[model samples]
Target chain A: MLKTIKLGLIVTLLLPALTYAHGPARVKVIQDIEINAPVEKVWGIIQDFCSIKDWNPQVSACEITEGNANEPGAIRTITLENGQQLKEKLIKIIPEQNKIQYMLTEPNIKAFPINTHGSSIILTAIDGGKTKVEWKGNFYRSFPGPNPPPELSDEAGQEALSSFYIAGLENIKKLAE
Target chain B: MHFHNTVILFLALGTSLHVSAAPFAYITNQGSDDISVIDLAKKQVIKTIKAGHKPAGIAVSQADKRAYVSNPESKDISVIDTDINLVLKNIPVGNGPVGIAVSPDGLNTYVSDWYDHTVYILDNERLEITGQFSVGHSPSGLDLSPNGSKIYIANRDDNNLMIFDRHKLSLLATIHVGKAPFGVTVSRDGQLIFVANVQSGDISIIDGKTNKVINTVKTGLFPYAIAHDDSNNRIYVTNQRDNSVSVIDLDKCKVIKTIPVGEYPEGIDIDIARRQVYVVNWFDDNVSIINTDTLTVTGEIPTGSGSRAFGRFIQFSDLP
Candidate 1:
């Protein structure tokens, strides 16, 4: 049994079949916030992949390790306030759709309790010049077996991702407003 | 998406069954642990059958008049009698059974164990395990040749495809493919083999006769399952991350079109009889029906949560 994955990330997105190949069922977390600002203003606040550190208070420090910010294949290492580091790679930046997609290039169980995580942030214009920010992610638990401890269980992974996205979205709304 | 289980209508076995039965798509919903049977003729869900925990991979066998579903979490396989649309038996297979396929004759069924790295052979009639053999790490997709002579297994971690003799269960050849290959398919004539590499985000086309890589077609991010449309001499691949399907022209061996689908599309199968393609979306919990001629999404039927019909999920209507 090979415990370590040869690749840094799981390419196939979310499904229980892929979960069987790695760990438990993949958990999906979606959090959104409405800000009293225009879509363009909100997108400008977090268009850069490295801007996550400025908007998300939990990310203490951020640096672009490879390629250019917001470009495909770009790698960024974000250091959390707790001192845990996780690497994420930019997959796409769709200006027309006002959506940005990225995934974790390195798994940090202590930080997120997940093996792999793919996420996207989208901004949609609503009524009254308000902008809606939605942060969504799909990830599997760090533990690879059927049974996992309380800290590394699926619930823990979901909770960690939900809280992370909620905090980020709230801050982005505040900043954009 | 919630489907009323009460509206499910069972097809009775007889002459009327053959006359009324149009092609049906069986979707294995992982989140809800059930199967959503979609009536292709009506383009709506016909029934929902409760399956084992975390049902994912599904293979339909017209010869056996049954469909086998892999439940990795439950560590077993659920056999469904297609006629009655009910679970006939639950056979415990291995540590983690993910990918599955039934032989052309419907006499044997192969199950891939992700954790154990083993392929188990089962007697479809007797509902018993007949043989088991080792393969590369994390076998995720299983496909048999048209003649049922050779079996194709995609080793996700090893980044390779293994060819085995269906009868002897002996290794024949191992060909290196792109990174993290998840779904595999063979042409109708068994002339070409297609492997969807998830990590590489491309499809490796192999010469079935020589067992060598012929060409590589780039797809949207994280290509998962593939569906071959032989009539149009093209193939459709589900891009999980891209939320779209890349239509590949077999003649040019290039992606001709990209059709946007629901979020997190995983499993895909072609209804050749109806000239339609069914793609299961995990995040959206719906199946997108594509018009083959137009290469556009014509309809979307809400299915159970985490709808992943990983294998050949569409049952032909001509079968009795």
Candidate 2:
């Protein structure tokens, strides 16, 4: 009877953990950059996920598994630093308007699990071959259970993501030139 | 051809003798998503022009008879025609454009892009963005000197006031002030610049000549806007969280009186002709009229519904 009571208490505590682990962690960052290129050139390069590996130092490979490239519902697997993987889906795409929106779908991070990820990239051509590329996104973590670790805080995560984008943009500029 | 030449000759004579008229005030209504045309002589909202999403800050150009409305959600500034009271064009600005100020000569309109931490310089005549200047984070309110020599911008994030030369659009100096500075106004004599520090609930007076903070005067909670009454040598500050207006004696650098107003007064304008103060209450949905002589609420003008839809930034002008 004593053993049964102890087991019941242990189950009560561990059951909540099991239920919480089912949901992925959430992370969000909103950033923008003004790229010096034509709107068409910037849009073309951003749409091709495979080219991201060439410019983005943190990203090793990106493969589109479903839907058309740059189209809604398109899924892509991305390999990040240290061979870690993340899956994302293109939720929206507007080529004529030079806007793209996407969300993270797979390889749910346990530390900073992404509950929802949405990004919008807009390209506006300014004078003298300059295109203002504004990239903004919101990330929400799954509620309940473990919170994001110190290194994976919203501010730090955004800084890392912005750096990656800056690197990729510099590469794009070099290639265009 | 003779008749056309005669008409052109009269037009040239008229243009040469043209007098600089008083500028019209363009007030952006965040709640209504429209711009209110205030005819200063009539002292009323003459017309409302539809603008982009969530219009907040407005700047008027006397030279071109145009107004720019900053719509944060839309990420653009809606350009309006003063004569027709209509949106003539929408110029794409940066993210979270909150505050706008036009040059004294009405040649350029400086828009503070809050989230992007940049100011977009739009050429008034060309109606295009000519240059961009980086400033402190989350710039909220902007004001230009009467002489059109310097532009003062209140950066909320850094709690600092940034000065830029109007001609070059180059950052001149950054003056530290109270916490969360929001509204900024330069005195008529060009000697003092008053900044409302929202978080500190006070106003910081900056010496324009020295480019340094001179004094700090306590205001009500969340002082959001400030305007100078040159005729009376007074400065009126709107306290949003406190729902009151604090009258500062400019010469003494002290609060003369704190008049009880409607809920969450955000925008303030002083009518020198009538010696009356018009304050837009964010929550009360009305414009509180205060008699400057008595320093009391004399009347109230009903505006939009809810706190957010109520009268926001107000400008008093004589233009129709």
Angstrom error at residue B278, model 1: 1.0
Which of the CAPRI classes, incorrect, acceptable, medium or high, describes model 2?
Answer: incorrect
Model 1, A1-177: lDDT tens digits are: 132241223222232343334563566788889999999999998988899999998899999999987789999999998898999999999988899999997686657778889999989999999988888889877666565556667787888888888889888878887
lDDT tens readout by residue for model 1, B1-320? 01222222233443234343658889999889999988878878878999998898999997876789999888999998776687878999998889999999999999998878999999987889988999999899989999999999999989999999987778999999999999999999999999999999999999999999999999999999999988999999999999999999989989999999999999999878678899999999999989998889998999999888889998874543
TM-score of each: 0.91, 0.59
lDDT of 2 by residue, B1-320 (tens): 33533454465555443232343345566556676665544555666678876676766665556677787757788877554556767999886677887776778888887667888898876779989989987787888888999999998878899999988777899999999788888887788898999768899999999998888999877798887888889999998645689999978989999998986677776667778787877556567789888999988766543222211233333234
For model 1, what is the alpha-carbon lDDT of residue B187? Answer: 91
Off by over 4 Å in 2: A1-177, B1-25, B40-43, B305-320
Q: What are the clashing pairs of model 2?
A: A25-A113, A25-A114, A26-A113, A26-A114, A26-A140, A26-A141, A28-A139
Model 2 over residues A15-53: C-alpha lDDT tens digits? 433322221112334455666677788777776655567
Candidate DockQ values, in order, are 0.31, 0.02
Interface Cα RMSD in Å, per prediction: 3.1, 14.8
